[model samples]
Target: MKIAVLDPDRTQADLITQVLTQAGHVVQTFGSGKDLLGQLRKDACDMLVMDWHVHDVAPVDILRRAKEKLPEGTPMMFITNSSGEDDIVAGKDAGADDYLIKPLRRGELLVRTQAMLRRAYPSQNGAEQLTFGQYTFETRPGRLLMSGVPIEVTHKEFYLALLFFRNIGRPLSRAYIHESVWIRETVVPSRTMDTHVSRVRNKLQLRPENGFRLVPVYSYGYRLEKLGG
Candidate 1:
């Protein structure tokens, strides 16, 4: 998952970024409210880790406006030095899902983040294998099977296919897919994902005839949609 951290303090921001990165997440850090809001205007992340203070911007105002820009119900956590009861209530009212006071506990932050992500994405039920119609994805060995027949696929292909199935009806942005699957690949080739998506489509027979359609979203990414019964 990708997370955007908004904190002006360099040390604190680096610590938060390192913690999230070590926990298997891509972290983007912003030093000011303007920068964070600008990023939000372009694209949103899976989660937001924000500080309550950012120059002249009021926490409540920024929180309320940022929430309006992001996708509905996206989880956001406030990490600040303020521990006042009134501030906590105001933060929640503005749109924070969770709040942590300054001097954060690394373990506590990770645990809260996991809980928030789990609640937001219930499709991840920790199953070793997942089935949709005749298609089966076994995560243990990262294999795919079709009606008891094994399918030969590269590592990327298996995980890419699994992502679509896990998010059956959702529109997955190209950046999101790349960051999730090719986590180590910093520079992405324009055609790299397209080629793999093509391979997955052809190999899996992801067509209307096969009960699914892998269609491209103009200027966005792709969506895996289920076909008719």
Candidate 2:
């Protein structure tokens, strides 16, 4: 999982980063709420952890804005020194999935974080295989098979295909797709996305016969639709 942590205290943020990293999660720490918000605009993460006293912007304000910008069901948590009932209520009202008091215990933090992740992504906890139509994706081995036969695909192609399959029948915007897949700060050119889409379409044989159609949504992005559904 990719996680973002925002805390003005470098020591505390580093501690959280170390703990999460040791748990096999990719983490990025920010010392300012503004910087974290800036990054969130161009990238997406599996979870966000924010200190209630972050610099530049109020944590509640940050949480509100984050909830508006991030995809639905993206888990968020608050780590703060405030343990007052009012503060906890405010954090929850502002859309935090969990609240942790400052001077966090490593064991408690890990347990709560994992619990929130599981609640938000129940399907991801134990599933290593994803099936769509005749294609089966083995996530552990990073392989794709069609009707039990392996299909040769580049790394990028496989990820692109997986993304499309996961969001089947949903129109994914170009910006969202780029942020989720490439995960870069720089803007990717439209032609780059187009070329990859073309490759994935041809490579996967996504056509009427395959019972899937990958269609371009005019000026928006792409959609993978199951034929005769």
Candidate 3:
């Protein structure tokens, strides 16, 4: 998953990124609310980690505004020095999914982040199988069964298909998809994403007729959307 960390303090933001990245997530850091909001306008991240009080901005305001820009159901957490009950309540009321006091234990941070993400996006949390309308994904073995008829797919194709299904209606950046499927490939091949996505779309019949469509993002990656029934 891709996570966005918003903290004006470079040290704290870096620390959060390191903790989450070590756990297999791709992290992007933002030094100010403006930067984070600008990025969110173009791409969607799986989760957000923020500091309740930034420089001089009012508490809960950034969270409230950021929440309005994020795709629905995206999880967000606050990591700050304060632990006041009222502060926590305010954070939650403003759309924060969870709160963590400063001097965070790495283990606890990881656990809370994981739990929040799992709850927010339950389809990909170690489940062996996931079904979307007529398409069924047996993730353990990377198999796809369309209306009970099996379909053959390569490993990358299976992963690509699964990623799209799990993130239905959300636009995923190209780098995020590449990281999720090609975990070790640092330099993305020029045509690799296009090729694999094309194959997945064709093989799975991901068109409006099939109740889904896999389309390219304007300048980012791709989005899998479920069509009207």
Candidate 4:
């Protein structure tokens, strides 16, 4: 999982990054709320750990903005010295998933982070497999199979396909797809997404005969719909 940490204190940020990294997560640290917000504009992370008091922007403000940009239900944690009831209320109201009072304990941080990830991305938490009709995904081995036959896919393609399978029958906006799969905030060209969609369609053989179809949603993005009844 990719995590973004926003802290004005370099030492605390580094400590958080180190702990998360050791646990096999990709961590990016930002020195100010402004920088973190900027990064979020072009990229998305799996989780966000932010200081309650940031140099340029308030933590609640950042949370609000992040919620607007990130996918629905993206987990956010607040690590700060403020422990007042009002502060806690404000954090939750602004959409923070968890709050950790600072002088953060390494063990507590790890545990809370793992818990949040498990809730937000269950597949990452140890679900070994996911199936959609004839297709099956083996998370542990990072393999995809159709009718018990192996299918070759690139790293990006695999993630993209997994996203579609997870949200089968739902229309996913292009922005959502880009952020979820690429984890970048930069504007992705339409053709880039289109090309990948085309590849996934061909590779996965999503068609009526296969009981599925990966179809474009006009101007929005794409949808993976199950065919037949």
Candidate 5:
């Protein structure tokens, strides 16, 4: 994984960098949140590990700015000294996937961060191209490919498609889909996920009457059935 570390303390940043490096992840260290925010290239990072306190800005503000630049669903972990519920809720509301209380734990970091990344983007699950009837999705590029020609897709649409494709014939609960696609654990109403699916279906030219369908599983959630099924 490619990770960015933002902390005002050089010592702390270096320590994290060393630890992440030893764990087989490429790490970029920043001494201040402002510095990292200014130089951040969101497309280059797989996950972000940031301290709750920074030199020039509040951590939440930095998170908001970072979210503006990053693709939706990028995994973010906030490290803080406070473990209060309010603090955790604030972090989650600010778009962090998970929070780590500082005086860091390497083992926990590796486990939680890896789990969050897998949930957001499950490339390690041995899936390459994902299909729904006549439409094919290219996981690497996050695009809908039709007969090898690329169709434009939103980042949210692409990630949602990945989840639907991974579950193929199985009905996935709304909570299950949200955790897989969105980083936050706050309950997102089912309608939000439904809206995204609707857009993706339209973009991919899927139609229920024509066989390819995005099926709502009654009291359950949703499933994408192949053209014949």
Candidate 6:
């Protein structure tokens, strides 16, 4: 995905750029809204990550102008330090699809980015609802529901869960998952996958009642097991 990040804070912009690039997305950073507008006038991006604060012109103005100039469907997210009600409302009014209160969590960012991408680009995955254990995953809609309620899962987390479910009762090596999900050249520490898996397990509501367990197959990999399996 091609992304544009607009933020006067060089450090934050750099951090975002690094994370997105590391995830194998092309990222272009601009220090101000004016620069972003100029670039947009020339070319539109797949997504935009805009900081709430920028010198002179407001981020909202840029969003409004971008909406007018480019396709109305351009995806965008707002990154902000403020969680104030007004700020959130303003961001929404400016056509921001999602809002993240800083400091940003990499997992959260990945999830949200996947969500935006999933929304912006429709999936060809045929399963509308996938059942594993007591939970259900809606692939095309990109939602995870447990006991009839929606549970939040980031894009990568959702993908990880889906992959595991598809291979239920089987041990899937970490190397296989890394290759399937992440950039081949990206050397993510072993612990990173573990952390993401842990998060999925924690949030999945998979239990005795739920009829599922994400079990670690020591020395080999992990498996998604159903009750009595």
| Per-prediction TM-score | 0.54, 0.55, 0.54, 0.55, 0.51, 0.56
lDDT tens per residue, model 5, 129-152: 666556677654566776566778
lDDT of 4 by residue, 1-229 (tens): 9999998898988879876875668999999888888999999999999888786897789999999999898999997674566778899999999998867655467768878988998766784677777899886567999999999998778878987887788898887687666653357788888998899999999989989999999889999998798
Ranking of models by TM-score: 6, 4, 2, 1, 3, 5
lDDT of 1 by residue, 71-174 (tens): 88789999767456777888899989999876765545765786798787667636467789889988657789988899999998998898788778889888
TM-score of 4: 0.55
Candidate 4 weakest ten by summed lDDT:
179-188
- For candidate 2, write residues 1-229 as lDDT tens digits: 9999998888888878876875568999998888988998999889998888876998889999999888999999998774567778889999998888867655456657878887998888764687887999876467999988998987667877887887789998887577556643357788988999999899889999999999999889999999987
Q: Cα lDDT for residue 137, model 3?
A: 85
* True-structure RMSD, every candidate: 13.0, 14.3, 12.6, 14.6, 13.1, 10.9
Cα lDDT listed for each candidate: 0.83, 0.83, 0.82, 0.84, 0.74, 0.79
lDDT of 6: 0.79
| Residue 99, candidate 6: alpha-carbon lDDT | 85
**For model 1, what is the alpha-carbon lDDT of residue 133?**
88
lDDT-best of 3 and 6 = 3
Query: Which pairs clash inside model 5?
Result: none
| Model 6 spans with C-alpha error above 4 angstroms | 123-229
Clashing pairs in 1: none
Model 5 compared with the native: what TM-score?
0.51
The TM-score of predicted model 2 comes to: 0.55
- What tens digits encode model 3's per-residue C-alpha lDDT throughout 22-81? 566999998877788779889889899988767655658878877888889989998766
